[model samples]
Target: MNCEHAKGLLPALLDTALPADETREIETHVAACEHCTRELAALRKAAHLVKELPEIEPPPFFAKKIMAEVRAASVPKLSLLKRILFPLHIKLPLEALAAVLVAVIAIQIYRTVGPESLRPSDMDPPRAPEKAQSREVAAKKVEIEVGPYQSRTPVVSEAERPQARDEQMRAAVDKAGPRRAPVSKDSDKKGFAAPPPAKKAPPAPDELSKTSLVLEKKAKQSDVETPRASAGAGAAGFEGPRYKKPEEEKASKPRELHSDEIGFTESPPPAPARTVEAERPAPRKLEAAPAEPAPPPPAGLARETGADMALDRPWLDESKKAGAEEKAEAEERPRAKSAFSAPAASAPPQVVTVRVDERPRAGEKLLELLPSVGARLTRKQVRFDRDVYFVEIASKNLVALVGKLKELGTVGKASVDTAGDETVIELRVEILGRPQ
Candidate 1:
């Protein structure tokens, strides 16, 4: 074979992988060429040196350790079924028992004491007093008998009097006119029985307008007048500082607190008709409304709100300003270029022509390659397109012939045809090398 063929064979022979034909070629070349003979000798010597180099020594104890371990006692063997069931036999029953115990305890606890335990007790028995209650009942009876036009306060012994008198006094203060409010002395009794004439509530200045509007409507109705005789009896019953009058204004005292520390005796509830109805109805809406409003927040809530506002204001204001600035920028700023830039309009139909001097088409030069490589030409296929041709050629010589074809410009791509024992290859050609 040739020098290139010989070089290829030499590498294979050195690797000991050369086939028979290639091996014979290598041997023949080595025999005739002194240069090849020297190269082979040097290659052999290098390989020998590599093989002769001192072998790596393993650690001294490595072999002993490996042998000792391999000869060591074997593991105790169990049947495959026992191995598979071993873990489950120990673990599964314990898991099941734990699960069952947990379920039972959970159920028992749930059935015994439940989530409702977390709720607070809100129930309270009626807290009205029994002593003044009889007196109040007496007052209501007299009020109905007297047509409710006359006051029905009755004289009672000092021992029979309850701090309810203070409640009565406070009721009076609540009904007190623009005049100065009576200073109440339920100071001794924390709760007072509301006596409308005696009931006193602090009139908040702001609610005064609403109070006035309601007060005006109530004013049109008839008020009970004190009878001359009962008034004298009531006046005489008021003995010195002990019978002191109730303040006409309500204080911020908690109902429960007053009862606890102050022994506050709140007024007996107004008798349903004459003595009680008016006082009970008048302040309930206003006082209750304010108290309810405060229920919306805990005492610390206002400070918390103020703190939250303080914390948020800077960021909120900055963001708002930033948004405004961004808006301003958007309005006054230049429009951005489109991100895609319209894909360069498909590169503007750019046509670059390459100089291809010798290109084979459906022409006479193609006839030069026809016979040696074995080609069957179809005259009709070559007739129409100046750049196309058809031929039937064997695939064996296809690569070599195609290599020569490239030197003549390009042979676009070949179309292979199988007919009987022959294969056909068709190709398109371009005559003009540059864009016109």
Candidate 2:
């Protein structure tokens, strides 16, 4: 029944599309509202004008012509070359088919050949050319020296010279007797081999005078060899520029002597062999020989030794002084205490028995009063008729605590027993309820 609903229905009413009930609603709204009536009238006028308007007729076959034009516009024009080269319907399908055929053929080939056929083991190794093989063989056969000297000379350190001389002598003896069979390289190819010849004998002593004299002579020779070599190089007129600086020449020393250059490879003449006893019994005494007592150390040495012993532990002197001081202080301590301080004679423990009515109330009251007398409850016991409290307090506060107890309850049996050196007294308070 609002203006909006009426306006919507007004158009339907003009077209006779609305039902009677809806039409009645719009009619009633239009009659009640002037604005709705004006709107309904305008709608009716517009509908009537529309009904009177002449119909517009399009060109003959208009839909067919428009569709033809749209089709023509939508399709692109192809050049002769494009049309000839790119016949999509045939070429695209053929290309796709060709690609599919190629993939299928590749897959079939792979499946037929298998991955194992392409493995490295199945292929033959490439062979080197004849000239290269011959060159490699020649290289293996060629003897090339390694190290500072490009000769067969072996480098020997100063320490190894004596051992090498001894070894050469031993090798000479062995060669004179019987030569050992040469070990085959193939026998050691599997890693395990016979022990080396050098390990058979332990090394001989190196302190021989002859060996020392030989070593000294070789050292002098090595020292002289460097200056001689330099002189020779200069005398021969080396045209090459000087590569070594003066500092380097000064800093560098002569190279170590090689075993071959030092003549250690030559064996010395064999000495005459001495007679060897097969076995001699170890010399033993039938009886144990008495041991001789050692002579005492001299007086001066003993005194010096004693002084050193004393100096070694200066703490002994300090400790002795400290101990003497402690002893003196210990001796004077009693005298000082007797003179300046008095001994406190502790009184014996006293027991106080207190009687009261309403024992529980009286026990609680005693517990409250204990702190004032500097006392603590040592023990508490609850009996059927009475409650007992044992308290510990200082001897000086004994009299004060007894007086305070008299105020709490009756002091029935207050007694002090003789004791020795007890600073604190244990008090027994018995609170008894009155008989009903």
Candidate 3:
């Protein structure tokens, strides 16, 4: 064997894989050729060194890492189309689902806007000869009745005729229950016409006398039965018609006043005398105090005039008393204070503008320090620009409050412009931060 063939068989000879004849030929070549001998010797030394080395276990997942690297290197660069359609295991199932979705969509589309043949319209069958004959007979009857007018009027079906429409309206009204009475032409004219003059015959003299006697008797009974009340009440708690005695009736005379004397104060109709009181029982005394008595009339006026004054104007005394009381109240009411007078002390709120790196953190710190320094937070305002906290603290504790707040953030100088009587100070702590 040549040196080239011997070199090729050297590794197989080292592993004892070569046949005896080949091994003998390779060894014979190696012995003759210096180059093959050196190559064989070097290979033997490497094999011996490998066998003498300690057997060390490979790292965890060594085989998996190597196989992954081999696979990555073996894979060819994919075109954009191939890359998009990669991962056949998952993509194939997705493609199948897409196909099914498309089929379902196609079915939905077909159902919504399908061809006309899929759903044909129903056509009526031809009428029977007997029915056609009956229709012709009906048409002939219409023609006989409306022969002359039919040319001028539009053709109307039986259902659309005025008589038929009126019948239908009546039927619908009957079905729904009548809402109102149907008004006819005669009734409409009668509704607008003036009614016949009511002929009320004058009552007979006998009936007139009887009615007057009944009314007088009822008036007398009510007057006697009802108790006498305040002066505001008419006569004896009887405001109805008052029957006069025989003397009053004879005394009452109807005197006409001329137009020239219209303004002249005529003597008030003489009050009916208390003859009814003589017939009535004495009235019981009322529990309520009597209303203020009307002022006594002058000596020139008769006693009857005093009764007239009380009956005519009982409200005079009440109105006068109310006016007097109102006048006294007006005099006693305190006058409003002048503008110059120093009113109650109320100090304006002092704003303490505080600049801080973090507003929320500073606010938390301020909240924690408020109670320790004897200050109470009245209101907390969170706005877009800044956070404001209203604090009410005693004037004595203001210094301590400020000192404690300085630890949280930079505190601004606040002027203490409090009123002399103001003991509490309202401090507005405005915490500011850098703009976002």
Q: State which candidate has the highest TM-score.
A: 1
- Model 2 steric clash pairs: none
Please give, for residues 162-213, the per-residue lDDT of candidate 3 as tens digits.
Answer: 1221222233334311211221221223332111101111221123443443
Alpha-carbon deviation at 234 in model 2, angstroms: 36
Candidates in order have lDDT scores of 0.33, 0.39, 0.40
* Ranking of models by TM-score: 1, 2, 3
Model 1 clash tally?
A: 41
Q: What is the lDDT of residue 114 in candidate 3?
A: 44
Q: Is candidate 2 or candidate 3 better by TM-score?
A: 2
Model 2 off-target regions past 4 Å? Answer: 1-9, 25-39, 51-54, 59-61, 69-127, 130-436
Given candidate 2, what's the lDDT at residue 177?
19
Off by over 4 Å in 1: 63-189, 193-436
- Which residue pairs does candidate 3 place in steric collision? none
